[model samples]
Target: MAASSEEFSVNANEAIRISLVQPGPNNRLITKHEFHPKFTYPIVGEAEQIFGYKGLEVELLFAAHDLRPHLQCSYVKKFDTVGTTSALDLNKTFGNFLPPTAFQQGFESEVLDDSKAAEWTPPGVCVKKYTRGGENFEVWAGSLLDMPMRTLVDNIQIFIVFFIEGGQFINLEEVDWTLDRWRVYLTYQKASKTPTPNASPYLFVGYATTYRFYKFQKPPKDHIPISFPPTETITPNTLPSRVRISQFLITPPYQSSGHGSALYQAIYDQVMADPTVLELTVEDPSEEFDKLRDMNDFDNLEPQFKAINLKIDTSPFASMDRGRLKRVPTARLLPLDQLQAIRSKNKIAGRQFARMVEMYLLAQIP
Candidate 1:
């Protein structure tokens, strides 16, 4: 039966309080324990309760260590406020060392009692006591001094569990806590709960990079090739110029939601706000040109490129329709819109040609 506080207190004093227990060969294994200073036990009552016998024959077992005879010890129970589990009073048998600074750091000692050695519990209270052994008569107040020397030797066990395996002592500061430094992680939060926070209007966060657009004084009149080298035939005229996104990830959690289009519009708006830029480059219908090819309208690719502002200053040749070869001069220039109308008369051919052109312009080249 669990003893009452008063009864346990009376019985606690009869037994010598030990904080540490050492067991096995070489005394390598040790258990750390705490005791309440005020708690003590009545010898006869404790023994009878332990054996579960009334007025029966009982004998105490003894052993020897370091030329000193080992005396019978009691299995004292300790308590903690946080939980109902009781710890053992093995402080004496183990003699484990607890650093004063560690105790002062208010680790386990954060729950110590002010009095009663046998009544000690986890978060055990600190107490001052005189050294028991001769020639080392000194007073100390920390739990480190209340245990046995062999117990201190077995601290390797405590080290393995509490630190190495249990991870009770972890360095949380070392963790990379921020998912995105300037950005934030976006969860598909329920619309009913709370509105999500918006990203900075000036900055954009992309899947892999961050950016902000820089305004230009004079935007080109037609499609501006954001890609390097304005002209394909490079003679150094298209000096390496830099173009940047207004702000990457300006709208996080964009998903397929119209937010992407809105963000794009915002970028356009920002550029438009600066009256100097009359035109800005954006993907156009030529993107669909890939699905058209292999028909009379196969030649529509070149014209589509021009219709979308990707003006082609190249030549076009006419194929022979009669046995008498007709020569059509090359280097012909035609507005893309005009050519598209001409090709549309042949529906199937027009579509096939459009697809071929779209693929060439939209698709990255090798």
Candidate 2:
């Protein structure tokens, strides 16, 4: 019976008929599969409705494979005059819900004449200015207390709302500029090679805000305290020992063109030049910004670490007492003193510096 069954097979005509039939869309074999797809979550307030929006609904769209998440805003509004309600696409109606000034077209035009360029000096003034890609760009940095710097920041702060998620407008007027802790860096571009006689010469490109904080130090026991009466106002230069980059942003059009990198490097150079700045740090950073920082810092520190022959010591441990052998000596495994000296010279924050050191050590392994 087994031999007879083996001999029995479908004819060529029957096989051709079977092969002609194709699976339907709903068939498992024909359907496309996705491990994870896009999804949305409703945003609700205390009343289970969107806040500050009447008859409007908002949902946050997220996807596992997407780099940037977006918000879907919709609204249903009834007009008394028309006596009808219509659904509205918030994105189209509000034009991305950004202020008009956020657009490049809204900026005024300026030409970079020789006399105008001379006004921007270096060192204590605007750190650097140059022409790139047929555009005149300048980086001006000053303390927040400066009236002109504060005014410039106020004009462009609205862009933060468009670039940053859940970002709100900052009211520079309410800030106590007298503290002298905040520093602003502005990037301006020459809007056109030829400008009308009265038109402004430059357009706003991007800006970053940095904070200088006091670094507390332990006073020697033998040192005597000198008490002084508090004055009406203290000067801005009492102490600036540590610096933190708080907010960094580049306009949509200017992003990915190396402007952001240039701004960051300029700020880094300025901080490094200051002898008082013991460490350079950043406030809570987004993943994207963190990646940018890692690339920049790694590039800057790689050569230094390599020159010092920084590598993991995987050799056999020296003979020691039983008690000391039981525990892992992390410091002994790596050159802690040399790393500390390099970190101090570079003025890198402790946590970031450690990450770079680990990467360098791993690279040296092979």
Candidate 3:
């Protein structure tokens, strides 16, 4: 008796698993995960099916600290080709989605090397270090012009596309000046247990990236043009710009805690601290991300909102006809000048500020 064609096909998402593994004495247990990719169409096909394989399992392991990648595939059995029908070449299939180094024969051993992986730390300056739920973590940031940072992102960029919906790759090949305008924020935590010899005791948490785009400022009507000497230094980092968080993710294991909020607040604090930064923004934020931003914004503005007392005046509503009022007098209900002042001082965009105002006003209801 022979089985049907459906018997030979497997779901690519369920079959593929990605794990962030730590350096051990040896690749003893082959860290296991049955995690699914958010999307598998890019790798296999629209159907997201792998044909000619039965009980397929693929593990894509990355170094816990540095994110060096290694991919391994196995299955109960691969069906033999029947003329035009052939079993998929799993490794070759995945190669399209991973960096070429991931397929290098000796890459797994190198990635598991604790001596180097332990020493590897998050790039850039440590912007914040705090603990939540008794777990310690730190967030560091670096410019994209950095070689090590660029290499780090290159290794993990594929995961961004895989985990984040509608995510795309960052063009590291951009010119130096342009690259300098980009920034990456990485979070890490020290190992809670013992460490290997001469190895780092830190593990990777997750990361976020930001791009600083130039912000134009209108000059005063009475201002005169002034020319600066060619010798004077001017760099993108020093220009008045709006920083937009391009991609953000807190790996599965570390999520559901306050880490995402902390990372976001860290970025906000860092960007706001920069005299050159005009404002902070996010590019195509997901719904989950929007909620996170809203939480942080609400908390951050609470004190400021309190000092000025952001209470909505109800005088306009008091005299409204019960059933005939066609419009709400927004101007009379809220102080536009006060809100605008707060928005400018806080460097929040108009739309976001308006949303926050709505949330604040609603909170005042008895």
Candidate with the greatest lDDT versus the true structure: 3
Better of 2 and 3 by lDDT: 3
lDDT of 1 by residue, 1-366 (tens): 655444333232224332322222232322223222221122223332222112221111111010011223333332322135232333321233222222223222221221232221212121211221221111111122223322321222222111121112112234233221111111111111111121111111111111122223345779685754332221211222111221122112233433333333333333334343323232121221121112212343445554455434334433445553334432244355654554432222334445555554554344
Those runs of model 3 whose alpha carbons end farther than 4 Å from true positions after fitting are 1-5, 25-35, 80-86, 112-114, 174-179, 218-235, 316-329
How many clashes (backbone N, Cα, C below 3 Å) per candidate?
A: 61, 1, 1
Worst 10 residues of 1 by lDDT: 59-68
TM-score of every candidate: 0.20, 0.61, 0.86
Best by TM-score: 3
What does candidate 2's lDDT look like per residue over 81-100, in tens digits?
21132323334433443333
In order, candidate lDDTs are 0.26, 0.55, 0.78
- Per-residue CA lDDT of model 3 for 1-366, tens digit only, reads 666777889998898888876545545323422255777776778888899988998878877677778888889998878446899888788766677878778765565554565456777989999987787899999987787887789888877767787887786655455437778999888756634454456677889998877776666889875853332133467777788899999877777898899999999998778888878888999999999999999898878887888787877777888774548767777788887788877888778888898898788788
TM-score of model number 1: 0.20
Candidate 2 structure lDDT: 0.55
Best of the two (1, 2) by lDDT: 2
lDDT of 1 at 5: 40
